[model samples]
Target chain A: MSARLACFLPLLASLAVAGERLHCVVIEVPSASLPLLREEMKRAAAPVADHGPVLLSTDGLPRRVTHRGQAPFVPEKPIPLGNGPREGSPAGARSFNIVAASGAGGGLVYDVSIQQSPVPASYYDFRTKGLVAAVPANRWQELAAWNQGTRSVSLWHHLQTDEPRAAAGDELRIELIFASMPDDALAHVPEYPPELTRQVVGHLSGTGRVWKSFSLACRADVPFHLQSSHGDRRRRQEPGYGDRVLAKFQGRITRDTPGHATLDGLLEAPRHHEGDAEAYPVSSEASIGEWRLIVLRDGPTFKAAAAAFHEIYTRRAHVAAKVNVVAIRVSVADEGEP
Target chain B: MRCPFLSRTSRWIGSALALTLAAAPARDRLHFVTISRGYDDLLREEMKRMAGTPVLPRSGKLLTGITGFPRNAGYQGTIRLDRDFPLEWSVQRSGTPGRTAGDFGFTLGVMRAGDGPGLRFDVDALESGTEHDFYRMTAESVPLPLGRNTWHPVAAWGSEYNQGMSLWCYREATAVAASTATGIHLLDVQVGFLPEPVVAAMNTFTPEHTRLARGAMAPWQTLSVSCQVDRPFSISSAAGERAMRGRSDDRGLCRLTGTLTQNYETSFNLKCQWQPPGGKKQPQVRFDVPLQPGRWHLQPVEGGPRLRATGPKGEVRVANVAAFRITAAEP
Candidate 1:
């Protein structure tokens, strides 16, 4: 009895891991343009696949299609396909259908049912006979949320060619849908911290790419807000109309060795406007480090500040120093207007 | 004892003859005056008092041949009529071939008193023939309606062969009933050369059509305009249209510098013209080589129009020829 229980325990653990579902998106493209799509996809991080049938369980959930000869049938109504073969039909276990329609121009359109599970590796294999690109369920959910909040997401397929070319007749079309977040779950999300909100002003020094890398760690109790106001000044000074302020902040940097560095920061960008005195905290990490800050500014004020900072840093170490001003404003929350 | 009716007719005829002789010299020496709105109440009374009266300064010569009009009223005190050519005066128009004529052209900068069709005027030049037969050379009549307070520069030139002629810049205030009461007020006036025909053409010339290339190009575009002018001028782009004033050059070539966008349309305006020296018979041509975003060059097309652009791949032609749009195409 103990030996049998041990084997069953391993099987139960595998089922629990496999049960973890992710959001799966399927894109339909012309079979002929798969090669071109593959070339373009190399620039981005997405897995591509071809045409095939998907299996769904009794609860209308996507299940792994184990056999090739599963009942490939289009149901008039959504039905729960049993786990195994039913009394009469041998393929009654597989439900849901991949409906194909004629797309505008000479292309095929497929109505793919988004699966709740992470797409298996076999789905991306071209040898498995399906054409699609599957994004990890967590990443897909984050992208959808970001797209809903900002409305800045754009999707288009580009044709790869050496010479100047027009849009290809047969191209891939990707459609993304954002799932609404529940109000109760959203309450736990923290608002952007005001402490880190500041206009960073500084300069860069030392030539030749071999400059020493250093980082300034923030206290665990307090959140550090690093922002630059250079973008705002540039927008205002630009001539003509349609001036737009572009603000970008790279959160964290990861390094495998002393010289080699990789930027791995999650971007949490809120809509930025001119004179909006608010700073978004870097991350949830208590102690943030492993970043080399390079600040560049011109004029007498910057020069004097840089010289003063350089004198202090050169005394301690052989590292170059940069002077930066973090302009922070205190909010008068209870102040009444007259 | 004498005939009473004959004596009365002879007395009336002798008085009329004396009045006609007195007005003859006043007609030859005409005064052009410009008044402002500040003197509106005193306009009619002043006009009546100054009529047929010569207002000559005590000293200094009358500025007959001055090009630009004086801005201040104090300067008018220093000028007097030329003593030698006091009766026979000639003023040369500025910026044109100085041709002397007997008559003077004046511009009256007047403002309307009320909201009504202010007035209309007919100007006629008195042409005296060799046999003493006089005829009137009338110019196009202009309307000086209320709210339209502009200096309408009109000219009345007699037959080119006639030597004895006088220019008249006149306006009639009787056209409108309201204007007849207030009368047209003359602010300031000076006799000078008749305005050149080129000046009139410059005011009226509007580019109704343009030819440019459409679609995308590697870089650059060329613009050509065929117009008639007598002097050097420039054509440039303004407010998305070719509306900038170009540098004056005898070469009739204009270099336009501006940044261009991809898949967008821009407009240009040709403001002036350049006429080559001793090339009056030659057609007026204005060429604009716009330096847009990328490298652009005028490709030499054998026996083709002078203005053409070449791109990195091939030559381009003006796509919408009538609308003036240039498009990239294989040469």
Candidate 2:
């Protein structure tokens, strides 16, 4: 047997077969609050059940005011449910029925399922409307639990965020609130050691193709590296959208310094059209944008962090572009942990 | 009571059967791989250089093999293609030109059990979260090998767009040591590319469709052709003629890149309009122009007005020009 196969044999043995019952735990937090919750759990080394205050409203707009008395924006429709631009996570449109609702610590809690009828389940969210976050039958396979019996053991929770259509931002943030099955469950849930995981959180925003940066505390024992979730953003749509120029962000944190870290941004704006196709990519002009972040640790607490942003814009395609960064949270875990 | 000779004969037969089983061709390893231009490397370097001065940073997250099985340098995996049934190739598509981040970055190459021109059902590359890599590629089922066992490139869909960082999939076979009966094939499959390098190296010019002062001329109008520095050594001009040029810097990076746009069915000429450095005349190179993945139709333009093509997963694409017939340029 290959070494990889041999190493995974034990993991395979721990998996629960189809007939077995699993204890499933689900947790939902604001898309932005996930990092904080992760940090909380990392320090405690136990599953966290309840996290307070949804940062964004049910409509996915930020609840906090940019200015006082800024009226809330009620979206006419929820984000489309078909395949997102990002890969993975089940595709095809799915609808859920809210079978049950109750008052919970976070706000109103509802039990929702893909089934047309009610099933025995409970999930937490801030509002009664807008299906917040859900794991479809297809995703249950990843959690290693059988979808049929999971309804009883699973808890559904909604994630709040502020992402408008046709804008450049982090759109779909799906967090598994928590999944805990008994030792004898039908599926084997993977676990990571406490020391290797760290949650990096911050905010990034800028205007007119210029990227900005924000710094956050870094408490990782290892050099901070890029995670797949760090680059996840909603697909933007606009004229010249097919142009290659766009915005991107990068994170830099190292264990050498200990307490400090930062997240930086790179932005690009389309200058002019170079070629044409009826339904294919057209060439355009744009400059490169690059940024970096680093953190320094002092004593027991992470006290210092710094970020830097640099952009190369051309005079030709000098158009204004806005980058609205939501609360950016990055979860860094051991590569072998999953 | 069995005789001693009968028992000895049975033992001998069992040992021979075990040896035959161990030496079977099924035990040979099947290697699957992919090779594409390192577009992401070019983009990252260009971005850093464009932002400021060049500073080489430690490379981030080298692909640990083909996504799921094991972390290795290149995207590769080993399994018995016959027994393993469906072998998957999970490629990480880190955004490139024509492909965006978050787009489904997958390439589906379907070939018959033997070999020939196959079908490229689908190809998509976009930026995505790491988790998506696990399910990015959809492994199409291949029939058991028939009689012939050899390594060759299967002409799948979009096999032409190999310039820069486009997908160019091929396979090779090697015989097991001293065993003519046993053979192992390494399938090197290059999937997608990064966006930055394509932008830096390639540029398409304006107006794919235009007319002369006289009136509307041809059914298919030749828009413009683009040339770049690093890739696509040649370009196809009007009427399927080819124009190839060569120029290089001190680093020997001389690659003539070109682009030709078509609206309907048009004819044009291929000409070496410009000379190389030192103004030396170069011989015209004849080659198949690799086409980028676009809305290319399988049917002929003259057949009907409506041409529809569906991907492996049923994604729709509409295009004209079934195949290119390159001819010598008329003087």
Candidate 3:
């Protein structure tokens, strides 16, 4: 009811019996990693590649859903001791530094400091991977939405880890990053890309309900623009499709992944006495449009999640569960493929 | 419906009953919500009302309220300024971590007898005779509401004793800021509870070295400084007058070689004078330093022989090192 009380209520609920294990669900281990703790999934039936991040929803969630961005590990303020040689990961790599949230389940989001990793070769956000955020006015409101039973962040990211015997067992790591909302973008969104609010909710085509909310944000500005190639047209294009119309939406389309993108949604954009055209164009770095929120939540035995994904896409959406982030290992092909 | 005569008699009986109820006054109760400060992170809070030292966890929020104001649910407390100059508000709540932590910054809000929630005092906003000197926050007799829906009256202050140079208070609801002068170092700030005899206990250390600025001294030159007691207060000291002293070497390796007092706010004043390497005005950097209380170290910086002192938590790091800008090697 009160801001103070409301914020604490969920955390309290989480603390109560938060350390429970459900019935075992077998899933493929990172082929490189191996079979999880509980049961095992046949590699043939559970294609790890098809599972992606969206399937972790407990149940009651659609299999195929899109998310813009999901942050797994974020602290109100990160204490940077700034000690030298204190950077990077445990299995050790140097080109980039790793920021850890180990004690909490979330694996550390890599921190790309200008001093350390300047020209990073990541899968998304150009070379850099993360973005800074502004405080939002409605974090409480967003949480209320989750409480109201319409949404849950579990859909976007769900992970469980069956740690080695030396490490503790039954440890689950779920990473989630949300913002109040950004100040600059709130003013900027309605004007330049007037249809973004409607577009994200799938106003154009390929419609679906919001599965599990990945980021509950207020005053959040997660805006980006990606221009693919020439001849990739938008909706209702008249005879005259010039370079300016193509360039106008240059930074409008955004895809954040280390792999190929294939957006499957209706496009919303300006057009004249329209024919069979999308308002926004389907785009990918290569042939055309295909963008989805590159959020990935994994569990130790992600088989149940993989199965859940199959259930959602195949036309069953009554399951309910909160997913989390265990570890997401993206296998990227050569850069030009996307 | 009674007849007119009967109705008149009933009215007389009702009046007599009303007089008896109004004669007895309701007992006033004062419950409180206390916010804790200086925390590493959030933790779970268990509530207890009677203990004098209500072992509050550092740096979090707590709000507790009873049925009435002042007597039953209220407890009195004092805020001693820590070296970090932290200032924030405290209120009681009934839910979640069950508390709300709001950063009042160097300012504070309180509701005393006449003040409720809307009134606030911006301590840093006050200046003495001209509004530019030291600012100590205190309370006023102004009554205001604490929350939007509850228009209860209250008297409040930030965190003041009787003494202060001056204080500025604003009722958040009225949107009006007011200033009151208390001339005493301690000021009274009230929100909900008025804890009497509020005393601040803190360490007040004096630095032996002068403050360093950019480009004034040669890169990486070692300098020595002395410390002496300039002021003392509620803080107890082992070395009565010995201000905690230390030094920095050419390589910027600094060690505070004294059994110095803990938690004292350390600062230094800067003035320039010429000094020859071995003269009486010789740099103190090379001297065997004993941190005797009330002892002064004549420090010389670029203005003379370049004197600098390093405090307990040496603010000097590769980050803020002035010389780093010039001689710092490019990695």
Candidate 2 segments whose C-alpha is farther than 4 A from its true place:
A1-338, B1-14, B22-331
lDDT of 3 by residue, B1-331 (tens): 6599989899999999999878845322222222221110010011212223232323322222110011111223333222223234443322223223331113243333223212222221121212212222222222222222111112111111112121111122222223321111110111111001110100111221111111112222212111112211111001001111122111211211211122223222222221222334344322222222223332212222222332225533111121111010000
- Candidates' TM-scores? 0.16, 0.18, 0.18
Q: lDDT of model 1 at residue B319?
A: 16
Q: What are the iRMS values of all candidates? A: 37.0, 22.9, 27.6
Question: Candidate 2, residues A35-117: lDDT per residue as tens digits?
Answer: 23222222221112235442212112222211111111123312222122322333222222232222222112222222111
Please provide, for model 1 over A135-254, each residue's C-alpha lDDT reduced to its tens digit, 9 standing for 90 to 100.
222222111100111111111111112233222222211111111111221232132122211100001111111111111121111212221111122233235523121222333333
Candidate 3: deviation at residue A60, Å?
A: 48
Give one digit per residue, the lDDT tens place, for model 2 in B1-331: 9899999999999999999978866434333333332222222222222222111122322221111111112233333434432344445445534444433344433333234211122222222233221111112232212112232211111121121222222222234223121111111111111112211212221111100100111112111111111212221111110111122111211112232332223322222221111122332222223322221111122211122224335643232222222211110
Please give the ranking of all candidate structures by lDDT, highest first, separated by commas: 1, 2, 3
